[model samples]
Target: MARKHLVTHPSTAMMIRDTKAAEVAVLEHHERLDGSGYPRGLASADITPMGPILLLAEAFAYWDQLKVTLSPGTAKALADSAFAFADSCLLALQKALIDASPHTTPAPG
Candidate 1:
């Protein structure tokens, strides 16, 4: 495929084949934790830690680009939805945000 051909980074290529951690995370970002994804129907435990983070980051970016602001509560609810996403990564991201913001109060979980 063009993707495989266009990638020139030896390290990245090796990561794609050998470990597949980064590849699965990025390439399979759209995949849910419940075996409801494309390219491959991978489920929880099958998905790596990075996958959830990458997927949430992508969602956040897209929402930002569209000027659609989600309240912390709404975002937290979506991330906490075990039926749709990975909770651990979302909680980590929320914690990071809370830690980074000096003035903003931490939202209740």
Candidate 2:
């Protein structure tokens, strides 16, 4: 199934509520940071914040579905291949995770 199908699929209609953010995230999910993706060629700042998050999650899910055991290095490689701005997105994700972790202590600046 094509990436656009995820946005227009009948099942998704029921599962996804009517919200601008939700719509943007779903519609832009397949968009790439380099403007090489389908449906719309959004590059860099043109892509919504949620778009990259969804893309990253989708990439990991795809690999997981294939039973690929992704070590940190493998995951980083995969993200680099899948996203043009993978380093920035990965860093942001890591920061988000660290901030959310109860056991994490703020790093000395």
Candidate 3:
């Protein structure tokens, strides 16, 4: 509700709505691994384009959060442990697809 209220006008809403439309193609899956449906009831499919990836990123971030900087062994260890937790969340299957890349977009070539 609050999120909706934030963009209670046209310009912002149209952009968000259209972006979601484009995202539909990317998120155009529904069949939950446990058997579900689409739209307002989506699960696995919702996670396809960006949802699952978000989860993975958050998990890695959880690890990254353990330290202030990405330095030597400590940083790497935190990452490893965070990923280990992310792995556990996916129960191994989903872990393989996870990416450890930063959330920021890459610069142009």
Best by lDDT: 2
Our tally of clashes for model 1 stands at 0
Provide the TM-score for each candidate, comma-separated.
Answer: 0.54, 0.62, 0.28
TM-score of 2: 0.62
TM-score of 3: 0.28
**Model 3, which residues run further than 4 Å from truth?**
1-18, 21-47, 67-109
Q: How high is the lDDT of residue 34 in model 2?
A: 79
lDDT of 3 by residue, 7-56 (tens): 33334435665666435433423223222433344554344444344434
Candidate 2 residues 55-81, lDDT tens each?
A: 767765565455454455744775676
Clashes of each: 0, 0, 0
TM-score, cand. 1: 0.54
C-alpha RMSD in Å of predicted model 3 compared with the true structure: 10.2
lDDT by residue (tens digit), candidate 1, 1-109: 6345224433564655555666556666656788776447678777776766777787666655555545578656786564366666656555655554444567999
Residue pair clashes in candidate 3: none
Q: Compare the candidates by TM-score and give the number of the best one.
A: 2
lDDT comparing candidate 2 with the true structure = 0.66
